[model samples]
Target: MQKQREVGNRVFVTGIGLISALGNNVAENHSSLAAGKDGITKAVHFESLYTETLPFGEVKLSNDELKALLHLENEFGYTRTCLLAVKAFEEAVNDSGLSAEELSSFDTALISASTVGGMCLTDQLYDDANMKFEGSEYLEAYGCAAHTMRLIEKYKINGFTDTINTACSSSANAIMMGARLIKAGRAKRVIVGGVDALAKYTVNGFNALKILSEFPCKPFDENRDGLNLGEAGAYLVLESEEVSVGKRKYAEIAGFGNSNDAHHPSAMSDDAVGAIISMKTAIESAGIDATKIDYINTHGTGTPNNDRVELFGISQIFEKVPPFSSTKSYTGHTLGASGAVEAIFSILSIQYSEIYPSLHIETNMEGFDAAPITEFQSDVSVNYVLSNSFGFGGNCTSLVIGRVN
Candidate 1:
């Protein structure tokens, strides 16, 4: 019989890096959260009719500049997707304090999450009439997996790597996958995260859905409209027990769950069936009761249906609803990157005991009493944090991050 996997392998997070509209790296992101700053601004990165028509949390990096910083191969056409990811990856690797030579000591791997890889490159190619592709090589790389391969080669770290594209839940699912890999003894150390840069496609797609909010998103608010699209990349390196010795471990990925409502292509079930199942599964896997969840990082996208359904799920399950926050208003809806972006917030919450508030909350929606802590808060002891990420296709994930030692 296959050995019943107890939480035998202790997976601890050692390194973290973030690049969001709110800030760059850990310090900036943390400070923005504290100041209750909303990073949503009018579109300036790309020329779009959606400019002020739709606001976004756009990063301050340009594609050419990013390629130079990452020292990307000239032969390979770099996109905003790869640029954002490498920025976060480099920061996380530095935070881990492990050089490329040192990484050889452990079985390290990368699992990246993204929905559109080189689509930005694909979209912008038309602008350059001089550019020509005689071979179909660029076509395959246009898909989301292309960035994962880029990350593996760029970093010179080797083990296993794959890409996940479960919409917004992608990176949270990536975190779960890293822990599973460690649990299965597949890799000792894993760099798992997600990255996505703002593009007209996503903006137009969500706009077509009529859910793109022009103003800053106000999740769980009575006046909340919908999410503001954003660009970002956030990554964390997870290490198994032996690999984490002497490292400054931030928090432990205690347990995680990924479930699907499969109810609709874009909309979630009004009853939050998927979220309920996912939360229960995650808490159980963490070997904790619902009451132990000290804080929750909700998948609050500021969407009309999501806010109502998610709150309903939390209220129905946890007895004393934990103080929850959605950093989306600060970073905007980061598409696939939202999962990992918020995971960084989740870990920071555990480390500093700071409850990052959900910005732009004007009023609480009916039936939801656990509204966001509109004002910033600090210095709270939290043992376990339930970070929830839900995405299109009803893909829902709940990750339990616990403080180490």
Candidate 2:
């Protein structure tokens, strides 16, 4: 473990796990990002009739492949979502250097987030619900907490565990809750993040909403169309200051803020009230002026309403908006998993003093002077990065990750 400076009452990220279309771990994802590679492609792994009609950031592993990797080929209650979650969770646990004994201790806490959960097995759930005799093996795996519950049982984790589902902001809330728990001395260490797998239900729903782009997404662009649904699982191990000492620490959780637009269920306010409030509150709680923020990982979903509003919100706060970009362009929109995925990306930027680019934007968004970082920047000095995640029902969250050095 790498030695870290003391951070009293603060939360430190000690481990990171990521499985996306880019790669299966943090190093791979960082490599793809730094190389300006985009992972969006025609859906081949996801089983959907619209696979050819739309692009998706589908992880290149099939269900059987994932099960084989996790040594759970015969597991009955595990769905695609659970398999994804387990793969990422195991990686995070190993990265954190947590022994089996430590994981089962009462001082450890688990907080995971997901929008799809076990709904990835929609057909099985539907069939089981209609059956009168012996139910399907997926009966217990149909709930929103199914993945987390499975992880708890598989690892014999006896710590506090909870699942959150607040649309796209689910995982950001999980990270925030984990930090709060550690700050309050409720847990010595907390593993927090989210997982989401592509399903016909979500794909069809977004299609019906007309936010499913047929091509690769272009965030913060003049002709930005819509989002491309993606499937991924990401996790982060956050430890309290006491537990983080002499450990491999990535970045410090400096501050966080959450808000609701309250103007629309699926759209943010025209003025970006929720986003403005969340960014301001986060900057204030971090005790830093707006000028101190070095970079921003925006929740730029490539939608017209979201991009314009996000720009307006940031403009209201920063005299000069910091270097900012949306990684969703690389991974597509991973929905519930996006927050944690981008959080990991933000920490990577700070760790390497680098910034990833936003791809395929020919024209910048109108009425905004600032544009996304279009090229990779290396060997730059970075101190703080603010990552944002906004969800349906107006849920918005912002997290500040700062370099320890």
Write the residue-wise lDDT of candidate 1 on 109-212 in tens digits: 88899986667653554434335545444554567877777777776766777899999999999999999999889898889999888776777788889998
TM-score of 2: 0.97
Question: What lDDT would candidate 2 get against the real structure?
Answer: 0.90
Write model 2 residue lDDT over 14-85, tens digit each, in one string. Answer: 999999999988889889998999899998877888897899999989989999999998878888889889
TM per prediction = 0.93, 0.97
Q: Evaluate all candidate structures by whole-model CA lDDT and list the values in order.
A: 0.84, 0.90
CA error at residue 383 for candidate 1, angstroms: 1.9
Name model 2 segments beyond 4 Å from true: 1-8, 132-134
Least lDDT summed over 10 consecutive residues: which range in candidate 1? 122-131
Highest lDDT: give the candidate number: 2
Instruction: Give the per-residue Cα lDDT of candidate 2 at 332.
Output: 89
